[model samples]
Target chain A: MAKQAPGVRIDGLTVVYKTPAGELPAVRDVTLTLEPGTITGIVGESGSGKSTMALSLLNAVQPPGRIAAGSVEIDGLGDVVGLRGEELRKARGKHIGYVFQAAQNSLNPLKTVGKQLLDLGRSHGVDDLRGLVREAKELLGRMGLDGARVLDSHQHELSGGMRQRVGIMLALVLNAHLVVLDEPTTALDMITQANILKIVREVHAERGLTTLVITHDIGVVAEVADRLAVMYGGRLVEQGPTRHVLGAPRHPYTRGLIRAIPRLVGDIAEAQALPGRPPTLATVPKEGCVFRERCPLRMDVCDTVDPEAHADGARAVACHAVTVKEHA
Target chain B: MVVIARRLAGHLARGVVMILVVATISFFIVRSIPGDPIAAHTQKLIEQGMAPEAAEQATRVLYGFQATGSLWEQYGDYVAGLLTFDLGQSVTHAGAPVTEVLGEAAKWTVLPVLAGTLLSFLVGIILGVYAAVKRSGKLGDVLAVSGSLLHGVPQYVLGLLLSAIFATLIPILPGDGPVDILYEPGFNAGYIGSLAEHAVLPVATYTLAAYGGWVLAMKSSVVTVLGDDFILAAELRGMKRSIVFRYIARNAILPLFTILALSLGLLLGGAVFIERIFNYPGLGLLLIESITMRDYALMGGAFLLITVSIIVANILADLFYSVIDPRVRSGEEVSA
Candidate 1:
């Protein structure tokens, strides 16, 4: 019953939040695509709008925030941005499974995991609830948990790692071909994070799913993602095959991000923290490249004109210096 | 199972201690009030043309206590009576037991106050959820403002205002008493109808006065729950709007249950003024009459009942909360 994994295309997607100063875009007009059956990761600093961009895929940006412009096209589901009400709701779980940022707090504290699982099945109009339960148990067991005991326990009874696993189980139990995991390991310890990432990769390949992992940690993306997309201040700075992007980043912002990760073996001073704070909604410049204030390769053109994403075969980078270098 | 039983036992023990303390304090407090009931009654009998000695004897026989008795002796008698579940006689009621008098009055207060509180809770919770969901809208503002306004209005004021409108202005419903004296007291429609008619004003007063508090409490609770990660996650899961709403309500309502139980206990005591304003013979009214007549036994009995109810309500709240919220159950078990 495994469906062929669906590719996702996010084109010119813009999400804005209403502020005292008026609507400010959290996600700017940018385009990216997920190849069928590939795991893609988008990494960014806090307030860089990576989470907002991910939410736009589900068209689930909360109020005080809205999708200003965009079309998110999945192979089976048409433009998600245009879907409304019951249609939009029905599409969420059955088609796109989302593991929320804090998997630890995502399950209802008042209910047993089994009860919540039944509730999920009932909400989706599942006729075979028993089958759904069996499937959920299998998924849980696959993740190295005692499925029966975990299902009967309340969320409080589960450790942080266990809760994160439960979150993953819930997402995959419905057999969604496209899954989004948002900071799935944020609160977990290093060992548990690695364990979860390993499970994620195994499950994605085993189920033939196209997955999107959203995080701020480069190490996370480097570990599991087939492709890496780096975001800074609401724009996709660079994206390509994970190894190539990490090995030789084209965008200066991506380079700084990679350099900021402290290494275990290297001289400690060699790892540098990026200078300046990330821009919040109010701080992002309106008419220039969003990263120019902190960009090491800032050109005159970066002050007034936004650089459009320039795509080469299987790779994209949005930076004036990169564009100039490529043309030269 | 063992944990739950232990917890229950713990709550019961604490409640018993609480009741005993309140009982002892109220017993002393009632005794310390000036003007002895025995002396007052004997003086009244003498004024009614009986001999002074005979009047004193009659007062002593009727009250079952000497005016000059030691405070410790009376306290011992009171404690002994309490141990046997005998609340002794009402000094003002001639031959009626304090328990019987309280029971009669309780029949009037408990149901109406309970009905009003629960009805208000239902109304408030529903409105509160609506308000929180539409927090930024005009309807939410209106409900919130009105709830605050009504909550601030004391029950007696509400009772008086309702009486003025329904009784004095329109004169449709009976203004006071549990039932009309003209009707034969039976299981018939007329008697039941009059009883309900007399109860309307007090119940309305209780509902209106307490309604705002529940609305405000529930609104804030729902608002907090709405912001929880699980709520957003549930919505993302494509749970139907109704299902999502159920999740929100179930979680939000958990905090309000303890408040609801305590309010149930407190509202009985608050019924004093409202009952007085409407002249409905509930425990509050009975308490007032007992105090005015210097009926120490009846006053102590009434106070004890109120204290007992409060303690019982708290215990029930703890147990009920544990039942609904597994987190609380485990914490309680650990503590127990």
Candidate 2:
């Protein structure tokens, strides 16, 4: 434990939801590392366990839910699996910071923004509330609102962008080392989304905060992520440095994702969409490649063997065809 | 301020129209009943008469019997009398003014209604918030189930049960009448405490009976609101559980506000049966009295007062709508 690296690390993390149909694994043996002072982008569509992964950090998943098997270890904090009562709360509040996707949510409408900020700041022992207010004012001012107005303002008074900025402020104010941002810009307009992402980048750099940004947009990953993890069917298909994974992709799923992105500068007609929708977790293929139904180069062996992570340079992919082709 | 004023004015206009229609309908409906007040009064005068002409003249003046006018003329005069706030003297009560009787009874009737409605609103909200926060667990499920169970039971049954237990068995509370505290009151705490003591059973009966409805409303609202994305967002902010509960409860509970306002308006109307069962001397009880005694003037005044009180309460609610809610402004802005 002492020798472990600083930041969030999950080894073989899995989550299963017990439904009327049966047990459905939402996250399947997903293992990755989010280093301190760096931003990691996780790209997946809805129901990709991107959210399940995020909630796993706080152990805040709803009932009929189970982590099943895995270890989620934060750098300074130990395993989050068994902690309960005040111990769990202290760890979640002090160590982990979470940012929800929507702006209209996350702040109390009944409370003033100043009070929300103050509550977080005071709880975490940032005794200098005046200084904190000054800092909050400065942050909101950068996002284009009168600093004084933001203090007295309720959430409804602000625009979507402003509300999201306040959300960012609420998460970052305590300077919690790890901030989990779940689709932070999805609900915003293009202009507002760009502004928010810009602010996120600026804040990350200025404070050296470690961020795990969950997004479905490959274009967003191309912009802000240092490394990328692509999840399909509740399992991570590929993860590596952003450039290598995007440019010299190995996994068939990863390859499909890049090819699917609409090309603005080149022939858009040449772009391809992923062959089929992501597989249902309830009835995932038992003894074969998860992507076999969609994979263009699937062999008979693909249906018989479960693929393991095969490394080619810094990139790791989970497909038998890719591994055999590269090895040959 | 302008919005509130405009809203109140609109409600007041509606209230005035409702009052006129209700008053007119009630007047005709009571009048259309079997016996005429004139004939009834004259019959008694005739029974005790010294001479037939004297009896006829006596009944005529008592009833404003105008042999020279048509029914329309009489109705016009009645409208005029109503406009001048003259409800006319009670035919049965012999010289007691209609307005004076109602004014005295209105306070007694409104007290129980006010107590019941407020208790229901407050208790329902608290319980609803509790049920929502605890949703998905045994506690939340239990609260929700129990609230539904109690809500499904008739209000009268609950009221009677309470009356039976406290009024009949223990005899700790005076179940039927308002205490004349000023006369028989002891100063252990003062007349106020004794008055409160006397009012306890009625308030409790009303409170217990009404609480279930509020609980169900609040619970459902909270559950639905909790499902919204905002609640998850707030939780992620690392806001304390208490703050989260408060914010979620207040915002999610907005629909309940209008329901509460409507309930407050219907309060006087609802109390009639309850007051009758308890023999409480409220407007509802008096209403029953006036109707049974065939006293048209008193009954008309009572009905008008209850209708006006309801309208006024709703108007007050409309005025207060924006005060408790910030989203109201944004909603108004969008609609405007």
C-alpha displacement of A152 in model 2, angstroms? 3.1
Write one digit per residue (lDDT tens) for candidate 2, span A174-264.
Answer: 6566778888898889988888888888878876777888999887787888889988778888999898889888888888888888877
Q: What's the TM-score of every candidate structure? A: 0.96, 0.87
Given the true complex, what DockQ would model 1 score?
Answer: 0.75
Measured by lDDT, the strongest candidate is: 1
* Candidate 1 residue-wise lDDT, B1-336, digit = tens: 677788899999998888888889999999999987877888889999999999988887887755466999888888889989888888788869999999999988998899899999999999999989888999999999999999898778888999999999999887788789989999999999998998888888888988999999999999999999998998888888888888899999999999999989887788899888889899999999998888998999999999988988999998898889899888855455
Best by DockQ: 1
**In model 1, what are the clashing residue pairs, if there are any?**
none
Count the clashes in each prediction. Answer: 0, 5
Backbone clashes in model 2: 5
DockQ of each: 0.75, 0.44
lDDT (Cα, tens digit) per residue for candidate 2, span B1-336: 667666777888888898889888887887788876666666777887547788778877766643455656756766788889988767666667888887777777777678767876788788778887787789888878888888777767876877788878987776776665365555556666756766676777677767778888888888787877766665655556776666677777777887778777777777776777676778888888788667877887887877887788777766666778766645665566
* iRMS (Å) per candidate: 1.0, 2.5
